[model samples]
Target: MDMKIMRAIELGKTYRDGEKETEVLRQINLEIEEGEFVTIAGPSGSGKSTLLGLLAGLDKPTTGQVFIGENEITSLNENLLAKIRGKMLGFVFQSFNLIPTLNTLENIELPLFLNKIHDVNRAKELIDLVGLSHRSKHYPNQLSGGEQQRVAIARALVCDPPIILADEPTGNLDSRNSKTVIDLLVNLSAEKSKTVIVVTHDLDFAQKAKRVIHINDGRIQ
Candidate 1:
């Protein structure tokens, strides 16, 4: 049987503003196997990103448990959660969160540097893998949106984390660029055997995944 890399049980989240309470997510149960490509699809206000945050250990659920591999992340302290995130999870944001001052290679190497790991050769290989070897020295401002997103993708893979969570990864790109980025993500899951989860509203993009999870009103559909 394939290993279950991520699982959420009875997950829920609520926001409190003064005396008002807003429930964003409720009873979200999910399981993702290693090396599987999965997409969470929903319309606006459907809580897709909120669920991704919980899965990535970026936020705590108000109700149940989240297991990443063998660890129940919901019970881990912030420090330990940070360690888990750095070692086992890679995140790609919709904004392509690249450092403007760092060149392509430097941006990709930043994660390793933060982890106190020096592996320039690995970084170079990732650049090549993403087909961005020629733009290694170019800054984020110097690259096009697609190139910037590619750099972001390469950076996310530098640590070789087993799980990758992308939140609306193609939200900022045109159709052509969106297709390229989605293809790259799919290839990552297939060729590298990475467990990839993407939160997106684009049905066409979500269709590329091995599994599509439709979420509405914070419930799995």
Candidate 2:
């Protein structure tokens, strides 16, 4: 049998605001094989992003478990989870979370720098892959929204993690740029054999995935 890179068993999340409780996700059971391209789609408050966070080990589920490979992440502490995330997962956010002061190349290299990995060649390759080689020296504020997002994608791939979790990657781009970013992500899974799970609202983009998981009211539909 093929390896399952990510799995969620009866996963759930709840938030408390004083006397009230909000159930964001409930009984989300899922399994993603290595190199699969999966898209999670839903309305704004459907808990897609919340599920992404739990899968990435950025947040613990309120109930049940999340497994990345053989490790049960819900039981791990923050430090260990951070280490696992750095080594096993890459993340891209909707807002280009690039450092304003850092140039494109620098922002792409930041993750490696934090992990004490000195790999300039790998960083350059990712920049080239994202077609941002010409703009490598530009700062985030100096680039257009599309350019910044490309830089963010390059940064996510710098670590070359087996799995990439992208939250509304094209939410800030125009139709043209959105297609570009989505195509790149598809190539990452098909050509490079990376497991990619994306949370998106775009039906057109969701249709490109190998599997589309629709969630509504915190439950899979």
Candidate 3:
């Protein structure tokens, strides 16, 4: 039986500007089981990324709770939440977010180094997994948009986290590259048994997921 890896109950998020307050998410109740490939799809400015941030423990919600496994992350302090994120969540951003000076291998291994661990073999394995063995020595500027995104994915997996949260991973890619990124993400869930969740505005890409959660005007539809 699959375990519940993530959950959100009546989740809500709001931002304030002086006397004005804007709500981004409203009463969001969601759950994701282990190894499930789920896509959160919505139109522009639909709070998809905000929801992702909350799920990733990168932001605080205005109301409700978020859980990862048995941990109620919404109630944890910053240090504790950061630890949970480090151990359980891996995030891939729309911008790739690779270091410009580091080679592919170093960039992917950054997380391990931060934890005072050094294992070049593990980094090599991810490079091969992402089909970037030939370009492992290349820097960010030397890679194409797709290649950079692949590198980002490899970096996200360096810690071997169970859940991958990608926000608009294919946003900057062409059709072929977009397909490549999606294929890699899907394969991670299928072959690696990782719980994968992606946020995207592209409807066709959203369709590739086994399940899609559509959001509009801060509500799930």
- Give me the candidate number with maximum lDDT: 3
Please provide, for model 3 over 1-221, each residue's C-alpha lDDT reduced to its tens digit, 9 standing for 90 to 100: 43799999999999999999999999999989999999998889889999999999899999999999999999999889878888898999999999999999999999988756667699999999999999999999999999999999999998899999999999999999998899899888999999999998766667778899999999999
Order candidates by TM-score, high to low.
2, 1, 3
The residue pairs that clash in candidate 1, if any, are none
Task: Give, for candidate 3, the lowest lDDT window spanning 10 residues.
Answer: 111-120
List candidate 2 segments past 4 Å from native. Answer: none
TM-score computed on alpha carbons, candidate 1:
0.96
lDDT of 2 by residue, 1-221 (tens): 54999999999999889999999999999999999999999889989889998999888789989999988999998888888899999999999899999999899999999888987698899989999889989999899999999999988889889999999999999999998999999999999999999998877777888799999999998
Task: Compute each candidate's TM-score over C-alphas.
Answer: 0.96, 0.97, 0.95
Model 1: CA > 4 A from native: none
**What CA root-mean-square deviation does each model show from the true structure?**
1.3, 1.0, 1.4
Q: Count the backbone clashes (under 3 Å) in each candidate.
A: 0, 0, 0
Report the Cα lDDT for candidate 2: 0.91
Candidate 1 lDDT, tens digit per residue, 65-134? Answer: 9999999999998889988899999999999989998999999999999887777599999999889999
Comparing 1 and 3 by lDDT, which wins? 3
Model 1: ten consecutive residues of lowest lDDT: 201-210
